[model samples]
Target: MANTPHGGVLKDLHQRDASIQEELKAKAETLPHITLTERQLCDLELILNGAFSPLEGFLGKKDYESVVETLRLADGTLWTIPIYLDVSSQKIAEVGIRPGAQITLRDPRNDQALAILTVSDTYQPDKEREAIKVYGANDKAHPSVSYLWDHTQDFYVGGSVQAVSEPQHYDYVADRRSPAELRAHFKKLNWTRVVAFQTRNPMHRAHRELTVRAARSRHANVLIQPVVGLTKPGDIDHFTRVRVYKAIMPKYPNGMAMLSLLPLAMRMGGPREAVWHAIIRKNFGASHFIVGRDHAGPGKNSQGEDFYGPYEAQDLVLSFTSELDIEVVPFQMLTYLPDTDEYQPVNEVPEGVKTLNISGTELRRRLKTGAPIPEWFSYPEVVRILREANPPRHKQGFTIFLTGLHASGKEAIARALQVSLNQEGGRSVTLLLGETIRHELSSELGFTKRERDINVGRIGFVSGELTRAGGACIAAPIAPYEEARNKAKETISKWGGFYLVHVATSLEQCIKNDRTGVYAKAQAGEIKGFTGIDDVYEEPKNPDLRVDPTQTPISQIVHEIVLLLERDGYIGER
Candidate 1:
């Protein structure tokens, strides 16, 4: 039999009556407006769709406290995570939010009204306590903990929401399913036993094998329900992941599997998240949920230790199986046997047998280097989709960041490299020199450390955008701070390659080469906070290419940079 919805009943908060909805829509304009954050939008969608069943609205303080402390609601329903509508104090003052008041929740993206909230209570939450209890740590290393401390609003407002309309989505419309829709679909297909496999990453052969095995074990149909909501930082974007999922869907046996998209903003809470996910699956009419090792665990903490035990999520889900009304399918690690050309669980493999395994890091490295991804590890169609999304380093966009002291020949080298790259002529080349950026982008900015950081950050942002669009950005700045330069690299590397070139010309040489006498004026206290004189120029600890333009000719420095770019596959061989 299909599992019952959580709390023994699915709560439908949508205003199905057209007259009521029209009345609410007309009244929403007169009500106070509150903009919903991304997380809040995801929560609202689930709440309206009955995925968060048994609860008719965002939790009041009592339910929030109970869930945070004991993984249960105030009514004793098994709810692992607290869902609350957080608002800033300024927003509260603007909206005059109070008990018995009504407010329209506007979508931040388009400013469209999605729902209306009847404010029941407004109060400040103990974020630290919630973090420690729910995520097992108050440290910012955990993504959820960090969000709670840094991004969350100062006040939480609890209320029952009247759905004005479902949030708009333009992409993958056919794959997005609500809890009620999924339940009805399962019933129509006569799939009483459904096993749901949840994932935030791209699906590969191992994932397919694991899900298939899990379904076969329980004699159930499989649901590939991947989260399209906010996942960890640096995760593959949903567009690419969905493309990969679509490519892999046909590999499953006919009528045995289905693909669906879940708009879940994962908390990466590991054990608690495992229970939460199981409950959500149960509400979606799945009879079983797969709990993999380290389910929803954010990688490592600051001290380089795993945040949760390997089997902690599985164990926790198993313990709550009865209450959750869903079977817990524990996932085991799978390995490829080259001799048999089949994937087998590690425990089932014979000792001393040869097994082929590819780590995620290795796959990414291969992708970046234009190395071939074996079919045994992932399907060729999936790899092709990934490659299209994440092209090889040579084909992708990139930024060459040049940092040095003033008059260290950075501008000359930057111009020469720009000319060289333009001559090569495959991608658009943009040069962002210090003076040019100052005049064009940061005209109002000054030379303070904070201003300098902001200026560099702007350059990084621009460079990242250009790189993502497959352009070459050459940035020349006396970005003296290591932190700022590192931030630029981290930002640009997300979409394309970032190569830092340090022009390590000595301070004496720079002073000699300063035809404008800026360094001399700084030494004489005429110019305040002048780099390499009043202020310090921290040398790059590790740069992709380091050159002293004083010793190496301008052409040679440019050649070295081009060589490095070509060697790293950022450009074709000259």
Candidate 2:
């Protein structure tokens, strides 16, 4: 018999002989009852070289030259039972293929028949069925996760998997607050007129311009609501994205624009997504929503086509304006104009402004190559974000996030606490100032609720790790709620050095100081659901230390925190 590339595979298969068949049977029996779309099945067939056909007779043989390499499974070790791509037979007919015909593939070794598979006879309209089918052992077929993972490296600069299916539905992590809860949040504030800004990507000048314009036009309070969920293919994950947001948050019109995560999946259907986005914002209590060109579009399609025309999504939303029960604010694409040295909408930009065509792909190439990302695409804080991302090759650290409102003394208190910890010079203390850690830690997690939880959760985890390693971490964030604080406490306590130091900054002083203009903007009705204005701020019932930003000095606050740590035995050595 002539030798073939799969000769060794066949030999290995034969070696295990009965064991191989038994293993295969077991794997098949335990195989997840997964189904696939017609296209997905076709793709699988292409990948498998037709050994497992969606139509017809079983018993086919094909050489998967690198099956062992692809999966760590050995020959005769019973890899997962052969899975057939599932598609509607009607679709099969539409494609002009004969139904119920057996398909075959050539076996690389001796042209031997080795395996045969079948396809589902019908489509499963049930979503739960689809979810189960998509997640199988050794199957990287979670449609949403797979799609994003497949394309993220191509589109998102320095992209990496940030978070997958995680929960943060309780009040400790997110204050358990909902859109309906906005009414009771800040009893003194008027939320009658609210504008919610929508973003699937991190904010830049262009986003700022659109939000500013929208807020000005509506004469309403702006809520900077960004999604932190599984987005379109190639989009950055939500975990890191939230950190980039937190860094530049001080720039947002404080109190007027509060940031929050939207736990929703992005279909990237362009016009349909825009319509869907509007409906969601409305459900979340937004009176007005922003829809820009190609809103939620998944970029170009096969044949190099833009999924929907620039204005298509906007037009569709406007058509259903009344039905959506929310006002539509259409925005043009924002471009960086060199003349003004800033970003402006395509329509209003001056002719003299030089155009900097910084595509996301180009930016990612730079990041991957260790090149400096132009400031026009993202903020300096975001640059830091791109750097700190650890791609899970090893679990050496955790991400710890400090969250809270503006002028909440989070940064100042964090600094003082860091200085105190630094006094333990021998210990490997790593202080991740929220603003500084955007590049390394926050780049992967996008601006979604799940992402935020992961980001904040990582922060807590890291702090706990450092403390356990005989190091100290002083993370100061306007971690305003109980859920996030609880997560930190839990993570750190597990490591044996847990502390929740609440930097108490009263809403009155935060508004009066007006360093960021956010509070002033909220009062002027330029923004809504401003965390301290329109959104609820749940105070810690009891904290290790409470530093009133209104009256305490930074030094005193830091000292008090250190004392608490020492008293609790979290100081000196691990």
lDDT of 2 by residue, 1-574 (tens): 1111111122233455576666654544442222333233322322232111111221122211112122101232211122223234453454322323322222332332223233212222323322233222112233332442442221100000111111223322452234444434433466676787877776666677778778889987777777654465456666777777677667767666666666554545556557656755665567899888877666654456664688988997887765666899998888887666876778876666577766677765565445666777677877778555421111122222344566777787776666666674544556776645545778875544455557667777778878656555667555556787787787775544556666667777767766778788877889865567766777888776666767878888777766665554445433
In model 1, which regions exceed 4 Å deviation?
1-15, 444-451, 480-483, 504-546, 572-574
lDDT of 2 at 462: 71
Per the 3 Å backbone cut-off, how many clashing residue pairs does candidate 2 have? 56
- Candidate 2 RMSD to the real structure: 25.6
For each of the candidates, give the backbone clash count: 0, 56
Best by lDDT: 1
lDDT of 1 by residue, 473-539 (tens): 9999999999999999999988888999999999999999989988888999999999988887888
Q: What TM-score would each prediction reach against the true structure?
A: 0.91, 0.41
Pairs that clash in candidate 1: none
The TM-score of candidate 1 is: 0.91
